[model samples]
Target: MKKERAKVEEVSTTEEKYAQWKSQVPVLYDWFANHNLVWPSLSCRWGPQIEQAVYKNKHRLYLSEQTDGSLPNTLIVANCEVVKSRVAAAEHIEHFNEEARSPFVKKYKTILHPGEVNRIRELPQNSKIVATHTDSPDVLIWDIEAQPNRHAVLGASVSRPDLILTGHQDNAEFALAMCPTEPFVLSGGKDKSVVLWSIQDHISISAAADQGSTKSPGSGSSSVKQDSKVGGDSTTMSPSIGPRGIYQGHRNTVEDVQFCPTSVQEFCSVGDDSCLILWDARVGFNPVIKVEKAHDADIHCVDWNHHDENLILTGSADNSVHMFDRRNLTSGGAGSPIHKFKGHSDAVLCVQWCPDKSSVFGSAAEDGLLNIWDHEKAWKAKERIGTRTRSTSPGLFFQHGGHRGKVIEFHWNPSDPWTIISVSDDCDTIGGGGTLQIWRMNDMIYRPKEEVLAELEQFKSHLNTCK
Candidate 1:
């Protein structure tokens, strides 16, 4: 009888805990839904200092957070479905905390100690491999599956890093990009240089290490020498884990770099110098076509139109977004932007072209608004899709404001055309950390205008209650 009583108590305790967690889920979801915040229900334990968030797919999210401006930042991989769903969301969080684990959720403290991670990018072809750049000169490549034992406290299996690429002497690397079709990665730094690293050798060495095979020369070593130099560039080479080719053209800090979506051999870099230079991988780092004075102020972000290879978009500190056509550039002269978008009240920090939509693009600004623009109508006023009154805002299709601070970075889900995730630097309440909000295009656009307005009003009321 006593044994049965004890069993009953244990079952009751488990049920109580689950019930408590389940009850809290709706409250949090309502808070977000009421405000039309569109935040994922799954919250991170680490305070809101998320620097960047990238979606691996519809199912997974990678978030990098910096704590205390120090080394060993936290890398969190979250399950997007578990995050967005109210039904098993709390259970998933509990499982994560217990470290019993879910298939898609995991967190690790990066082993690299040089400085705060400046950027984290998931390889386009291989989502398993993530590249991280720090204030230090090295870019570390971590294999998510390699860290089996990362949750040691949870008694998980152990896994170590696959490779690390070093040799950038620039003070700090602010941008990193991986070619979609090639086994190459690009790093741009403060020293006005961009270096490309080949991953072929690293992959071989990593495979050998995983099998516990004999180490090759410089295998498992943090640094390796450059095998060869291309482009006749001034950057020196050591056999250490250095760049395969060095490209030097930017006169100021390289803020962002991206490989052309359709061509593996072509890539572009934007910088504080207000120059956007396109480079050919085969011809080394020299600019194939340089657009001088691309913006009036520092250009913070650049992205290529997947559908139109010649169309490039840029966002700048000058509070504007500009589009350029590479085919029309004149030699030795600045090319005028074909379309200029003016709406943001502050610096436009980031811009991204929708992967599925050729004519649609999104921009985030320091003004705390994410604006969607369509070139189909604005390309020629006569071809406009919707009604355009004399008083209508030009080029602007939709405006979303949920972040209380500057929206620093945002990305559209490649798998879901309607979804986007945005990260901010701070929050409205004192001591509140940063914020990450997920927005749906359907709610922001396809819904009835009256429905959208009602949700906005509910959100305002929720804010007042929080205050």
Candidate 2:
């Protein structure tokens, strides 16, 4: 009975805090859009830009709908109209209903997935081509542009995958990534292995067909097709391709994997075993460098810095983010981290380096806050005088407290500078399905104080002249 009372108190406290946060949204965010989901989404990703205008741009957004068996699980392809910076009114951005959908987002199509979509990654070479990890051993690839849209009703047929990646001996549900430099795909699974496959042949065939090839796509890699329902044309079996190579290093379920932004041959993976293994395909199947004891608990996510290949970030159930310089890493020890960020109150779920800035990165967690950190501030803070009386989270310049539940996933918009899309599983806490938010921090908060002060001075002078 006492525990239940404590739980009630906690919920009440959270609600009060959320109320306060909501009231400050206009001042904290330059622009904000809140779209309530009908079902919870475990993953969300930004797709390619489709259209651009003076005021707004339309881009494709990918999301998953994890349904309750009465309906089929689906991969949603939506069109999001991103308002250009400073275009949206502060009042318009803040005044949004928690129960209503946003006008800026529209569902373009839906693909009924074979299983619940655990993760979704777009091929950098071709954004329309996406790979999804499900509760299966195989990774399903879909050409979102070519796939026939379907209604996600009960007993509906699963949308056929354009290509299927088969390698893992056990379920490969979560860890998935697409190479930025090449048409390579990477995945980690319960089999304790990291698998790599090149979809170059598939991409070539697709390109040739686009130019009017008479021959159908086949005869490149070893392909297999099997019938399950054994009925009709609607019972489609997708063509599957085996992995080019499989690297084994992790002792437990691999939770996340990321490719070196500049190279397809180099990549990294983090797992439940609390190990970070860096792999170079050119060297061999063995890990180039394995960092033992990378975290205190299961490492949930990892990100390789795009601008600096030497820097790697890992977030773990230990509720911390660690930055490791690959050049200084050694195997068989508590891997040395240049710095450890302790900001989240719970397990960190996702981490991504900013597309525009190398030193900036975002970490989302179960703590209901997405903390944005700039590691350069750690060293710079030391040069300041009387900045604090006690220790605080270094480099944490911003905390996005828009969600009332665990932030499942978030993606930084590459096209729209400083804009971010974040989703949270809010069914239990807020009594809604989930919350999808698109927001950008106010420029006044992150801009250099001196520059901002100068701009304010100019504004004040202009106001005095008008008076």
Candidate 3:
């Protein structure tokens, strides 16, 4: 038994045996060179060893291997152990904990659920009152007053939503927009309908429901007083309180709808029919202005310029963004777009006019790129954000790679101009499957002028050292 164990120990290890076999085989260096097939120096441990190798061309090659053999007479692509440096290891571990696990990522404040959030918008001048429309028919009103430290406390403080608005017939509501001045909310869904909801009425009903549950059964005076206080007026409290208005004219699914920043009564709706219909809430279903064939393909989003209401921005599946002038929609006028911005590699999904700057606006596309364009610069983008892979411009000031999937919707924080809230289909959090990511301008690549200059200098120094 001792002699047999010694003989077994004498047998070469897998790496040693592979090295000896490689030395005995004739190297195919000339064949690899002729076909431009260069063997990578970086090694891999577990793969089929080549029993026979033939190079046809740069794009085509032939190989044959045996399941069981003393290793083949081919290039040994050894698996290399990528030992990370101390700094790299720390970064890897930090990224793993932040992305793979929960409680470490600090950017997300609260996780809203029940369904995937389709659209999120804050009430005008009220950052705390966030209205989120989901795949579900109901719209969830979140009161983000308490900021939780741990991931577990994310949706804990936010008990039931402040209010739930439900009027859509379809299962999913795709678009949502809160009135800037009024106590109204507008939502459009796959049902090809737009429903306007009253915020005050919803709140009053919720308050009354809560009060009724808490009041004692026999306490007549107390219950009556509470009912009167919560319900306000009997006329105001309608038993069948529903949507204020339900507008239906779109032949296809309403992709996006937005209220004119200047006129509360007037709003624009775009759908899969490739039409832009301008509607007045007071006029019922009749559209004030309807522009047919808004684009070659389905229109995804539309935004009214905050400064110039006449200027309307529309993004389409045709991979182009058009700037339309409402004034020039006549029989004998400049029929085409005033200016067309075409840089996105894929269909444009969302567009928004800058809250602070009038000339500047941002557009998000299916290619996972956010482009900022200034009207003054015509078609040239002022700055590009998100990814650099498909962008045509070289001046990408800030690139965000946090979202693993397509970023469908993003909104600039009204209160904090530097902060941006974006939602994605694929989120990194374990518990919160699809999450809302809050990005701060300071935290991104947007650096100070001095810092940028310092980085340039450092890069130049490194290049000189390499030379």
Candidate 4:
């Protein structure tokens, strides 16, 4: 046993108080190690850097969200990390007026969902409770002194979700990113930039948010969409998309992003500027690897094929989605999307592929409509079997996700690919004041997978017969 000793210079009282105040540091674990304390910290554990503070438990986490001159959102216990599944433990919405002054919490809340736990650990350093609790929303004004009982408390209505990914300035629409390498959520706001969060080892760290009798008013749900794919090849597919790396190298705000379904790292992005960038996660700044005078107008959405990592698809505000190949850029051929999905009347908001159906991706527009892009018939090659001569058309159930508002975001559930999760606001088609809606695919809907496979098979047989 290594003997760990505390350099205690003070025994007690007067002169010792000055000595202890200056010298007293913190330790992690205290044991009978020759009668002393020991603190353990990571020398260099291979993990992502921590960019922001996060309160967390094993199964959940909470984030502090702040914006200029406006109330912000806080998470109770939110986990969207692909690998580890944490529910949430504690959370708080922090508002700092003056540091040393008695900091009052306008929104101190705690959540204990089933399978979630609340805990705290003792650190030998200067300690403060990271999480807290309140009886109701009006604890400060309602007088915590008068109403001692929490049974009658209620939280004022506001949709404080479990995660806050992006921060904002003056409420402008800021873009945010998720660091797949780090479990933290990144955000950007009024500054027109980005912020990253680190939340891996906050377990048992004191959380400020605590459960209360107050019913949170106007609480609603916000969701993040991860993966979308077009079904292809009539073969078994990998459940997850890959060659995963942060796709960077944009000079402006990235308008749309998509993963290459067939090639894990092969993906594409279009910027607010008229530029298209292609990348492989394993590769770097060279991701300006592919470029095109993609659109005169700003680019809107980018998508990739389930079977071809080289096949890149894009949609733009210019009312067009173009396909390009990796070889076309390298070989200098007249390479572009084999066909353009040219039916939408307004700017396209989102695009995704039906994971179960080949050559199918869904597109949403400002016009409050969803279009199913079926590429099976879009391609017209002399030979069609496993060939890139595939074509695209409208899908059968491309309509409102039961919402009558303008869709801002559309996501396909990974577990159930046909399920579309769309967020729309009051003016569009999301009927009532733009709520997030979950729409189910029609069971009676039809997909021509078997037919496409049969056609490709016959084409292959013809080639074989000729050879």
Candidate 5:
């Protein structure tokens, strides 16, 4: 039994080493050879062994095989230990008892229902090169660049028969709003400035949906609320903002900028500092809320809530995720995170809440695992989430092993409430196809479907009486 356990643990450890090295240097040839490590691809027939990564709250825990391997990713996967799972988000509370897990190994949640993991083949015509991913759901846009490759993929439309929108820039990473104040939109990028243009004025619109994890929205309001009375028929392609105003705050490259789904006028930014500044397109420089020490590591991504105004999610390099309360700033560091999600074994790449619900969010790490948690659950049982430093025991609802490369990005779908899509440029996570995958909420993690269903029905009946 020890040998069996040792073998599995060996795999987990080797792969882990590889992950650490690969994060900076894409290739693992030289690093692995120096460490006297055998390549899984060369030594084994089934290709490099895949390990499991679990994101406990915002951090990650990667279970590599039990070995003193050098490269983090190459350590073969080790024992599958379940840690704290499903910590929910509670209201206006910072300290909770949910256990904290490492970010490296966010156990891969099984997919009882594989979602539509299809790459778009019929891309919109006149599509330019790619720049970055956007959040305007349904449509993805691209940068119509005179120069290509530096940064393309401006954005994308979500559906077929799509309409593309893009930012006209040479080398700047401009902020291209699908819909901003009135029919006008704002384009802010690396040029260190913002340009306002009419949605139709550019005639050069590209197809886009701006796939991103926004937490909340005022129905159809655009970032930096423009005119209240817009269009009723603006389906997926409808413009978001009205009027035209450039938002300038950051002195350096703007790492991320997101509009509060709750109020169009509300926006936020985190970049080049230990600063997370909340903004209102209406006013510049003075952020509504400014947070310092947002993360010990660089803050990579932030998402607004879909319903609650006081709630927002952030992913950082310190290898953790945090829930920030916007509405209330407390003396007990009241505004401090209602909870700090620590589980990523490596730097967390991105985080997003389900478009349909704020409580449901997904986080990805450099270690290559995607994690889904009930924000509410993590908040309520915050103490029971991950392995406590004193004890290394796992919690329930955790995936043991999944993915073969650095999980770059994953997003929850709005149109199909239960669907999720993840894309990885990782060279190692899944051996070969480290390809994009689509997943749906399933009973794979929740076994005994009948039993779970019975529980849900019972709960529903109980709720009905209260209603």
Candidate 6:
């Protein structure tokens, strides 16, 4: 009975905090949308931009439905209308219903997946081509444009994948990545090994055709062995291909993997063993540099900066984010992180560097907060030690407190500057499956102070003339 009371009190506290955050949306955000989901999603990703208009833009979105066993899991494609910066009025942004679906987003298609989709990664070479991790040892590939849309009802046949990359000895359900420079896939699993595969032959043939390619991505490759599905409906079974290489080093299950932005041969992985290993395929399947004790707890995620090849970011179960310099990782020795951002109060789940800025990054956690930080701020804080400037949290500049539960995953919109899409498992807190939010902070908050002041001064002068 005492524990029940404690649980109720905790829930009431969460409600009060959410109420306070919602009240400040108009003042803190330039544009915002909240869409309630019928089933919780473990992952969300931005797809290719469809069209651009003067006031808004259209883009494809990918997400999943983790069902409750009554029905099969599904892979969903959605079309989202993104409002242009400074175009949405304050009143319009403030009056959204939390329980209603946003008019800006709509379902485009649905694919009945074989299992719960744990992760979705779009190929950089072809955005329509995506890789999904499920409760199996293989990575499933899909061509969203070519796949037939199916109604997600009970007893529906599972959608067939365009290609399958098989390598792991155990379930490869979470750690997955696609190469930025080439058509390659990387995955880690319970087998405690990192696997790599090349889908170049698939992309080459697809490029020659006018319409989307119907050819199996790995059909003609010498390194990849294709096995036809033999079952009740053979047409519905996808062809599977074996991995090119597997690197083993970690003692526990690998949690995440990332490729170096400039090279297909180089990549990195983090695991439950609290180690970060960087591998160079050209130099064989052994790790080039392994940083032991990278975090005090399991590292859940890692991201290599697209702009700065020397910098990498990792988030951990220890409720902290660490920044490491590749050049110094070897020189400074093991466990030498350049800077640590201790902001999240609970386990940090995701961390990614901003696509537009080299020094800025965002971290989401189980604590129901997404904090944006600029590493350069740490140096500036030290430069003002003796002055009147007092710093509380040096690197953190923004805190997104909109979610009432743990933020499962989030992605920065590469097509839209300073915009982000995030999903949370809100069933326990809000009596719903989940909540998906898209928001962009007001420009005045992140822009240079002098520039904002100059613009406001000019606007004030124009208003006086009109009077």
Number of the predicted model whose TM-score against the real structure is largest = 2
Arranged by TM-score with the best first, the candidates are: 2, 6, 1, 3, 5, 4
Specify the poorest-scoring 10-residue window by lDDT in model 1. 33-42
Clashing pairs in 6: none
**Tens digits of per-residue lDDT for model 6, 292-369:** 889999999999999999999999999999988898776223657888888888999999999978888999999889
**Which candidate leads in lDDT?**
2
* lDDT by residue for model 2 (1-467), tens: 99889878877977887889999999999889999999999999999999999999998999999988889888999999998888888888888998899999999999988888999999998999999998888888899999998998767777788888888899999999999988899999999999998888665655766798743443245465553421113557677767778998889999999999888889999999999999998888998889888899999999999999999999999999999999887644335888888999999999999988889999999989999999998657645634564467878999999898899999999889999999999876877588899999998888889999999999999999999
TM-scores, all models, native as reference: 0.68, 0.94, 0.56, 0.45, 0.50, 0.92
Error of 2 at 21 (Å): 0.9
Candidate 1 backbone overlaps, count: 13
Per-residue alpha-carbon lDDT of candidate 4 for residues 195-290, written as tens digits (9 for 90 to 100): 222222121111312332332332221223121111112331212111112334555655544444443334556767656766554555246464
Task: Please give the clash total of every predicted structure, in order.
Answer: 13, 0, 5, 61, 171, 0
In model 5, which runs have C-alpha deviations exceeding 4 angstroms? Answer: 1-243, 329-334, 383-401, 428-434, 444-467
Ten-residue stretch with the least lDDT total in model 3: 28-37
Candidate 5's TM-score: 0.50
> Candidate 2: where is the Cα deviation over 4 Å?
203-220, 227-234, 331-334, 382-391
1 or 6, greater by lDDT: 6
Which portions of model 1 miss their true places by more than 4 Å? 1-58, 69-72, 82-114, 148-161, 204-240, 382-392, 427-430, 443-467
Residue-level lDDT tens digits of model 3 in 1-467: 99767645533332254344233222211100001012111100111112222411011011111111222112111111111111122222222222331221212233323333445566674545666665566666655554232222222221234456656777545567777776667777778787777676655655767787542232111111112211223432213235667788777888888888877677888888887777788777666677778788999888888788888889999987888888877533224677777767679888887676676677776654556666764533333433334535333243334443345666553433434444443321122233234333321133346887887799899999999
- Per-residue lDDT, model 6, residue 37, is 87
Model 3: lDDT of residue 359: 69
